[model samples]
Target: MAKAICILTGNHTAFGVVFFKSDANGCVTVKGEFTGLTPGKHGLHIHSFGDLTNGWISAGPHYNPNNEMHGAPQDEKRHAGDLGNVDVNEDGLAKLEMEIQHFHLTGIHSVIGRTLMIHQNEDDLGRAGNEESLATGNAGVGVAWGVIGICQSNISEKALEEKSNQ
Candidate 1:
């Protein structure tokens, strides 16, 4: 299985770490944990670039190579970066787990070189009847962001080669 990781950072005290793993079936599982967040829904996505030379905004927009409109994770027309929302608890801690089909850890559509974006507000999923909604799900300003990188797994190189041949 292919794997990746993102360690979130920003101008605030909030922090987050996310993991991505791919199964043999081509589905990618996203798992993450966060702290110091406002109690509510927050939009989570994968931005286009991993550049952080000028901070989070330098990461660019959502990873929409296909030029699709912003929408929910289940929306067939949503951008590749649209992973929907993650709910934060009153204690300011959030745990996330989801399966996605639009992106992967390897291959041409790999997200390993992209960036993860956490928005300040809940994603309207393009149903807000506004242009911003259709473009960004109206996710508001990015509160935190991180670059996705290839993770060195504990699995031995021999095992990885064997799995790839199967």
Candidate 2:
């Protein structure tokens, strides 16, 4: 049982708490929240590797642990990093929670060294008809990016304790 948390801030948006849970089988549960964003559906995914070198491009490919071809989140043939989209309300806020069982947040196949990207548009899931669609979903531009890090559970617990003490 391990935990990870990240705070993501970007153009016209600010948010905190991207929670992750590493399971026994090397899967991860990804949860995210945001206070501001365009009121609409937005795309979310685990980029290839954790290296925000040159903007979003540094993240590279989806977390396809099985080396499967691209497909929708629910599709059987899809990549491992496909967690699907998140919806934002009229207040430009979002609370996203989903389980990603195909990839790990720790160990050899971990996604820790990878980055999570929030796109400005919905992922058509390769329905747009193009080769690049499989890898990128033609999902417009990236609005926010955050490097995933493994946060020890004790750290979060201590923070909670400090808050209670205060």
Mind giving the per-residue lDDT tens digits that candidate 1 earns over 1-166?
9888787878576788888889999999888888888999999989999998887789888999789999999989989999999899999899999999999899988999899988899999989998999988888888888899887777643454344336
Compared to the true structure, candidate 2 yields what TM-score?
0.83
lDDT of 1: 0.87
**1-166 per-residue lDDT for model 2 (tens digits):** 8887665655656454578877776666667677667888877877877777687777787778788766677787888777677788999889887766666766666777677878888888877778878776767777887777778676664473344336
Give candidate 1 regions above 4 Å deviation: 155-166
Q: TM-score, each model?
A: 0.91, 0.83
Instruction: Tell how far residue 138 is off in model 2, in angstroms.
Output: 1.8
Identify the runs in model 2 with alpha carbons over 4 angstroms from their true place: 12-16, 25-27, 155-166
Q: What is the lDDT of residue 35 in candidate 2?
A: 64
Residue 142 alpha-carbon offset, candidate 2, angstroms = 0.8
Range of the 10 consecutive residues with the lowest summed lDDT in candidate 2: 156-165
Which RMSD values do the candidates have, in order?
Answer: 6.0, 3.3
Query: Each candidate: how many clashes?
Result: 0, 3
